[model samples]
Target: MTTFEILNGAGADGDQLAGSLNDALCTAAPMVERISGMPLPSHVTVRLLDVAASQALSVVHLGLVYGMAAERLDTEEAFDLAGKLAATAGSRFRMFERITWPLQLGKILYGPTGPELVVVPAAHRAARTSTRQQTVVMGHELTHLAQLELWPDMLTAGPRLRIKAKLTGQPTKSLPVIAPLFEGHAQFVHRDLAAELCGVRARRRLPGEAAPTLRYRATDWLGAVPPLSMVRAIYDRGEKFVSAVMDAGGRSLVHGLFTDEGSLPLLPELLKPELWLARHHPVPAHNAHDQ
Candidate 1:
């Protein structure tokens, strides 16, 4: 059994929206578990934030948390970083403004307390709050919940790697491999859940379509290196890798890869999505009801 608490932010409609989102999350949990081969926690907290709150969180996360991590700054240094961020927030407001809208509808964050999913309901108003879209977004965030519970290391790999580099004087490794695996796995689970629950089929990309050019500043931290476009590649390439894995071995194979940390493929192996598909030999489609 699963449960949720909605932290409504400063409005009456937030409660209703949070309730609806809670229902979507409940509906998505079992299917997400089935597809990802990881069980979700019995309880989850969903926070509904309006545009202002959402933008604030993004600024703090991107400017403060990410900046501190990337530079490995000390407390004194953090104040300087905070000052720099505050100074630029005015000019960069337009650039960072998208966080309040559809570009960032939901986020799954884990801290000392536990895991929480934060979403901006106002972000989805442009789409008139389509149930299918909401379901898909919920499913995506829920997959992150599953990852945090099951493979917490994957989510924190960046900071761990950075610390390792600082301590050992070794070169810091970018999340080229890790981010894709995490984001890709979430993307796959999202699509799988959508198919199972909403009868939506996975969208296939045309040749060359998977790697479109994306814009991002060099200084921006997007949970990985090369900022935005590379981050997008992580999703695009990751989905392809996950799809191939699922086609070849079904959910069991995915479960094996996810659970066995040591056996995870390296960057070279991950780069060749075609090889994985060829090796796995596509299996028949799964009947969602069977799970």
Candidate 2:
């Protein structure tokens, strides 16, 4: 059985809020496993961040964290590669004008110490408070926790090594390929759980909801990628890709992609919705959203 610890930073009502979140997690965990075909971690931590803390961390993430890590490269080759990436990122950042920190409801992050799921209370409170929303968000973050647990390397060496290799202009083996699959599969699980528990389709026809026509350019700097639109595209497009896979081959296929890198779909293949539908029989439960 998995256990969760909540580190609430909201001051007043923090404990009470943590309790609510804990209950939400408890209720959602089984559904997450059922939908994702993955097990939850034996132990997990959830952190609650108020708006100010969320903003401050976002600053650190974009500026000092990535930038300083880039500066610590031992080799001249790595330094030069980091510089080039920084230049490209800087130009993109300028055009976007501080798009790095969008108002997010929650995020799963790993630090030097360990991995934790962080949620913005202000943002979550602003949304319509419903059992469905709570279940979906909890299910989503829990799916991330499960991914990190299953791929312990992703938590331990994968991120730092991936960054260093990219900074040194070396080959990045799986992070870029694995990332969308990770998020897409999480999104699939979240939606599936939402449908089962809440009796509603999680997909929404919001702005920027259109599927991608072309594949995203492969880059090691996905973490530092500046375009908010492009970032949104990655999640949106990735979710659709996971949905197609689930529709075609069910949860097991999506789970296989996570557990085995070789089973993962290529970026171009994910971009083509028509191909997925033509080849694989769609899952009836998953296809209910269209009707």
Candidate 3:
């Protein structure tokens, strides 16, 4: 039976998917090093196995959610869909290798916390519609690795805080404040790096890309493609603030922004519109088109 049919039947036998996965891992080895800036640990090996094997370790698995499933998600369709999703998410796929795994059909899986990428026996990263897209996915994952490295304690604290807040009845809302800085930075940097590395820029965001106009004010332009006006507002304002600070005092003021020790706490203040504008001196009121 074809691999797709097998996956659709009983749970996948882990061994069935191993070889293809191994091949993909091998091919992506160089890229993993380049983007991560750290060599893979010699002892850390990648193996492709069925769902059961994946379960042995904490795995970020992909599966189809009912209603989310579309008939066109098979094989090439999966790659295409993933490519499109990566574009919206500002990521790309590298390559797909084969493997055997025990999982029903109609799903995709990967560990959000472990290894850069993974696929079941039925789907592997392959030639995407464009190489630029492949780089987008790969770049985003690399940035995720960078985030983990940069903030090793954040994840550990996240769950504990959530649980503690629940048990004690204290509402903990810090994550929302933290999420935008971290996720937004990652999202921005991933797209920036992907475009730089691949030499391709994505299309601008369209009108519907942003939330309803009532919820967000449109301002600033940073990304070449249309971005959610609010998001663009944040980046543009942030960049302008940072630039003005540097222009006045030079890199010393800017370097402080990158300090990892305790500088993270400053992000919220920096993101504030008033502070951002104050850092750059007053200017005549202007719309995006005027600038």
The 10-residue segment with the lowest total lDDT in model 1: 211-220
Q: Rank the candidates by TM-score, best first.
A: 1, 2, 3
Total backbone collisions for each predicted model = 0, 0, 28
lDDT of 3 by residue, 1-291 (tens): 001111221135335444443343343334545533433333222333444443332222222211122223334444444434434322111111112121111122333323323323332221111233334443443444444544544333333333344445767653223334443443444455555544544422323333322211111122223433444455454544444554655544433434342443344455563454354344567899978
TM-score of 2: 0.66
Instruction: Identify the leading candidate in terms of TM-score.
Output: 1
Models, CA RMSD each: 9.6, 10.0, 16.4
Q: Cα deviation of 51 in candidate 3 (Å)?
A: 9.6
Please, what are the lDDT tens digits per residue for candidate 1 over residues 1-291? 668777888376575576667767778778787777788888888777887776666555444443444354445544454456544653465464553244565786542245578887765543344455567778888888787776655544554444445455765442236667777888887877767654665532223323212322122335344444565687878888877777777777776666656545556558886555544454467899977
Candidate 2 worst ten-residue window by lDDT: 211-220
Whole-structure CA lDDT of model 2: 0.61
Residue 28 displacement in candidate 3 (angstroms): 9.6
Query: Can you write out model 2's per-residue Cα lDDT over 54-154, one digit (the tens) per residue?
Result: 65554334343344444455566655554555555446544442332223556775543466677766555444234446667888888988887666544
TM-score of each: 0.68, 0.66, 0.38
